[model samples]
Target: MKIHNSRLISALFAIAFGAMQTVSAAAETVRSLDDLAFLEGHWRGGEDFVFEETWNGAEGGVMTGMARGVSSGELKVLEYIVVSAEEDAVVMRFKHFRRDFSTWEDGGPIILMLTDAKENDVTFSADPPSETVKSIRYFKTGENTLQADIVLVEDGEEGGFTLVFDRAD
Candidate 1:
């Protein structure tokens, strides 16, 4: 291989500038829990079954929440959720529980890390790629309307459901 001096310098400069751009872009997406204050309120949505979620204001860099589903006037599913601002990234962990307090996620709470954030949207992806959920996204469609998309994966296939909620509080 013949390498010209000018070509070598050009390649080196390209690599250096590319690395800087990558780093700068990544830094722009970093978020803190305070950025998610919109989630602190009551939300209700669902068709066949009524589902409700409530999130508390972020305190000490953490927000705690819970969700439950009711069908036929009977409580069906319950979930405990926590979103925290870590040193490097914001993280969300949630666990589902049955009416009897039995867990649906036998392994452990599903863990997701903040991957993207926009003016009124935030997305968290499975940290290590869980079997049940691949990612979850929350975005505001209107001032009092919010939508949540829960992405799921099974058997190497991708599927998801979206929930549209109105401000309940």
Candidate 2:
């Protein structure tokens, strides 16, 4: 009976290990910015508040983009963003600006490192790891539609928001 029980335990352990391997394999690390070429173009969203983004195609291992938001016919926010391949990971760095062109960050750009990618979906984590904003994900839902999900982690609490974008070009 003791031997039988030990064999059953070993079999269960093997099965659990195999399942873990499968899960890990599904989250492949991002290799290049080429896979993200679909993101290039002008995209717009929001109704009461207008949001727009324009992304340049990848070139020289980098892709540059800009975003703007307007409310009540007044420019509210602006952002400059870039994606670049650095070693084994793709890094997304962005900086925010006010309508008056004043910078939001004092020191450096906010950095987010690619963590996992599959098909048209990609995930990025805060570069220095933040307690407030943890990760962000972009998903291509249709030929001309993109969705962004931002994950927030603060005070041991988790929260997030999603933004849907439609191709303007």
TM-scores of all models?
0.83, 0.77
- CA shift of 40, model 2, Å: 0.6
Q: Which ten residues in a row have the lowest lDDT in candidate 1?
A: 1-10
Candidate 1, residues 44-123, lDDT tens digits: the string is 98878888989899998899999999988999999999999999999999999998899998887899998888877899
Error of 2 at 155 (Å): 5.8
Candidate 2 weakest lDDT stretch, 10 residues: 23-32
| Highest-TM-score candidate | 1
Tens-digit lDDT track of model 2 for 43-148: 9999988889899999998999999989999988899999999876888998889977889778788788877777888888996676557888888999889998
Error of 1 at 1 (Å): 32
Which ranges of candidate 2 are over 4 A from the true structure? 1-30, 153-157
